[model samples]
Target: MTDFTLLTVVVLTAIALVTAALLIARLAAPRTFNPQKGEPYECGVPTRGEAWFQFHAGYYLYAILFLIFDIETVFLFPWAAVVGRIGMQGLLSIVFFIVVLILGLAYAWRKGALEWK
Candidate 1:
C-alpha cells in the first residue's frame, strides 16, 4: 500500500527467491570432485612459474581508469533513453557528469595511467 511497505515486500521477495533458487540448486545439481580441477592450469598446459607473482601497480591503475570510464557509459545509457522527457535540466546534468568524467580521464591520461609501460 505505502512506499515503504512496497519496498519491504520487494526486498523480502528477492531474498526469498534467491534463497529458494540456491536451495533448489544445491539439492538438485550433481556434485563431482576431481583432482585435476583443483590444480592451476592454463591453455591446457601446466603452469611453470609462481602462481602468486606480483604485478606492476601501473596495470591496476590502468584497470581502475578503464572501470571508471566503463561506469560512465552505464550511467549515460539510461539517461539517453529518457533524454527527450527530461529536456534541458537532464541534458545540463548529464553534460556536467560527462565533463567531470572527461576531467578525470584527462587527469589519468596526463599522469600516464593509459600507458602500458
Candidate 2:
C-alpha cells in the first residue's frame, strides 16, 4: 500500500477503535444521574468567579518558548546515541540545528516574548 493509504487506514482504525471503546464504556458503565454531574468542576467546592477567564499573553509566550527548547532537547537524545558511529558530519549537523534554535530563541528574546510581564 502507498504511504498515504497506510496512514489513512491507521488513522481510521484508531478512530473506529476509540469510538467503539467509548460506546461500550457508556453502555456498560453504571448510570447515576446527578445535578453535579453536569458541572465540570464538581469537587464539592463551589466556584466563585466566571468559569472562563483570560490568561496573560506572557504565560503563553513562556510555554511556547519552553516547548521549542524541549523539542530541541528531544532531538539531541537520538544524535547522542549515534554520536560515535557518525563522526564529524553528525556533529556538524547537530551544531547547525542548535545554531538555528539559538537564533530562534534570540529572535524571540529580542521580541520581548521572554519578558515576565
Candidate 3:
C-alpha cells in the first residue's frame, strides 16, 4: 500500500480505538453523584480569589527557547547516525545549524529571556 493509504488506515484505526474505549468506559463505569461533587473544588478547599491572571512574557519566552533547543536534539540524533555517509557537506550543514542555534540562544540570553525573575 501507498504511504498515504497506510497513514489513513493508521489514523482511522487510532480514532476507532479511542472511540471504542470511551464508549466502553461510559457503559461500564458506575455513576455516583453527590451535592459535594457539584462544587468547583471537589476536595473541599475553598478558592481564595479569581483563578485567572496575566502571566509574564518571560515565561513564554523561556518555554519557547527550551522547546527550540529540545527540538534541536531530534534533528541531531538522525544526522549523527548517518554522518559518515553524508560526508563533509552534512558536517558543514550541521555546523551551520549549531551556529544558528548558538546565535539564537545568545540573543535570548542578551534579551533576558533566560532570567527567571
- Determine the backbone clash count of candidate 2: 0
Candidate 3 Cα outliers beyond 4 Å, as residue runs: 48-50, 66-86
Give the TM-score of each candidate.
0.54, 0.56, 0.61
lDDT of 2 at 67: 90
CA lDDT of each prediction against the hidden true structure = 0.89, 0.90, 0.90
Give the per-residue lDDT of model 1 (tens digit) for 1-117.
999999999999999999999999999999899987777878777767787889899888878878888998799999999999999999999999999998998998898777788
Instruction: Compute the lDDT for candidate 3.
Output: 0.90
Pairing residues by index, what is the TM-score of model 3?
0.61
TM-score of 2: 0.56
Tens-place lDDT digits, model 3, residues 6-114: 9999999999999999999999999899876766782678655665788888788768888999999999999999999999999999999999999998998898777
**Candidate 1: clashing pairs of residues:** none
For model 1, the superposed segments whose C-alpha errors exceed 4 Å read 1-49
| C-alpha positional error of residue 95 in candidate 2 after TM-score superposition, expressed in Å | 8.9
RMSD of 2: 5.4
